[model samples]
Target: MGHSNVSNFVLAVTVPLPSLLFYLSFVQKCDGDRWENEYWTWVCDWGRLHPLYLVNVLFFLNVDILFWVVGLVQQNVWLIDPYWTIIPVLIAHFYSAYPAAQYDLLRSRAALLLIWIWSARLTYNYFRRELWQWGKREDWRFTDIRRKDPRNWWWKSFFVCFVSQHTFLVGITLPFYSIFTNARPWNAWDGLAFLVCLSGITIAHVADTQLHSFVARNNILKDLGAPTEPLLNRGLWHYSRHPNYFGEQLFWWGLSLFSVNLGQSWAVVGTAINSACLAYTTVLVERKMVQEPSRADVYRQYQKSTSVLIPWFNRSTLVKSKTS
Candidate 1:
């Protein structure tokens, strides 16, 4: 292996070693009598059945349960938002480190590099939006839901915040599991997947940057006692009302292509579910937008001429035709 590949491999193997060792030690300490041996054997067998998934489940539960507890104590469920950008990168490395992992070296390296880039971009955007504040606030949707039922929010948030996100995070990352299991030589499909993944990352980065700038400028306008812009209709916003959402969906789908290349088509299930969720989220966001008195009418007009998710030609011409 080249120096770069060797370095990546070493990092991957070490990143998850502490957790793996702890788990093994616990298992060993528990093993003894017939019944205990049988239980441990069953657990080992389960791990053998799908080491990558089993490890991920353990990791997910550990991190998620902690997040759940912290959310309850802090009265804020925003912790997972930043981690959403992080978990996939960790999972990629975890998969790479698993003893049973068998992957084409180049393919694994490419996947890891792309995942790191994606994670960095998303993490940066998230922190920027938060103004580098940690746990300042939860998502608006979660806050709304909590306000609607403060009485039940405590228990409800367990399932709503942690459990649902567990499914989405693990499901959407199915491609990582698939990628690590296949040892097929890198080929044209790998190249195509790389391009798609890179394109998605680029699109998302640009759209998010544009949106961030708009928000920052609006804050300045508000501070100056000037009327803030009611809507962002420049850059990617001109092409699609939710270009960021589109870019996010594209990223997951592009990752799914890697699994498809390995004949693990089932991996697409996670990406599909994620897209469905994003579609629903888009609806809620637009509904919220239209509820704003200042922006309602203008946003409605913008919606008429702009695609909801995908980038496309402005439909202003069609709007004009209908009016005529």
Candidate 2:
């Protein structure tokens, strides 16, 4: 409690939750045409949609319960980060398995491939930080929130962190469901969606790589008894305070495009809400940067001079140009 050790837990806490969710949803139910089983008739009660909808809800609810229990017992609320990285893959693969009359398998394949690439990059980043190692802990953002209200942090973390993330996951994944069901042939719109998604993935990869390099260099400097530098302002960091976050938000919006082009216009609601959530996340992260003792002043300048999330023309450079 004196100093928050963010990364100090076993991989057991992180790995099993998603594996269990997958087992419950896909593996366990895969015994010989279970969807056609008669039990769903009673449970679904002749709803237009199948019982898998209910299963999906229960699956997430189970996930929440698991998170809350693990969070309370381990006293580590950071366990959910890995799940965040992989949930999209789970949702995409799950929905894509359901049959459609003229199912665009190619489109689903493209979406899944892009999502997997995104997932792989994020998961690698998480592991590279040694978060999967025992004693490795949660992100500082969650730790800071807990520190703010220690007495009530347990319940607050449950609702604010776990529940909020669950809601966002569900909302953001709606388009995947739409894409799976809509069997429209590949068109120019699909091509556009593919290009947008590819762009997002590439942007995020570059941003993450630049960030990792900066952090590693700083660590090396600190270890060698040299002066550590200020926050990163080069590469993608120069244009936006959170280029990775911007790329992530754009990626989801691009996925939403597939649904929209397929004529599921309502899917835009999910994309819009998800975008707002990412914006809120950016605000929270910036708030943390402004409050940190070491980072506050320098980060304040960065925040003032750079776009908060979007990558726009560098304001600092523009000002320097005008001044000269």
lDDT scores of the candidates, listed in order? 0.82, 0.74
Give the least accurate 10-residue stretch of model 1, judged by summed lDDT.
26-35
Q: Give the residue spans of candidate 2 off by over 4 A.
A: 1-48, 99-102, 131-135, 293-295, 322-324
Tens digits of per-residue lDDT, candidate 2, 1-324, equal 122333333344554566456545443444333355566434334322553464356545666777777788878876677778877787676666543213587888888888899899888878877634533677787888899999999889888777777777767877787777777898998889888888888888889889889988999999999988779999988999899888887788888899889888787786788788777777887886788888789998988899878899888899999999
User: What pairs collide in candidate 1?
Assistant: none
lDDT of 1 at 40: 65
Put down candidate 1 lDDT per residue, 50-106, tens digits, no spaces. 765675677666655766776787788877787789778867776776655789999
Q: Score residue 318 of candidate 2 by CA lDDT.
A: 99
Task: Please provide TM-scores, in order, for all candidate models, with all chains considered together.
Answer: 0.86, 0.84
* Runs in model 1 lying further than 4 Å from the true structure: 1-45, 317-324
For model 2, give the 10-residue run with minimal summed lDDT: 1-10
lDDT top scorer: 1
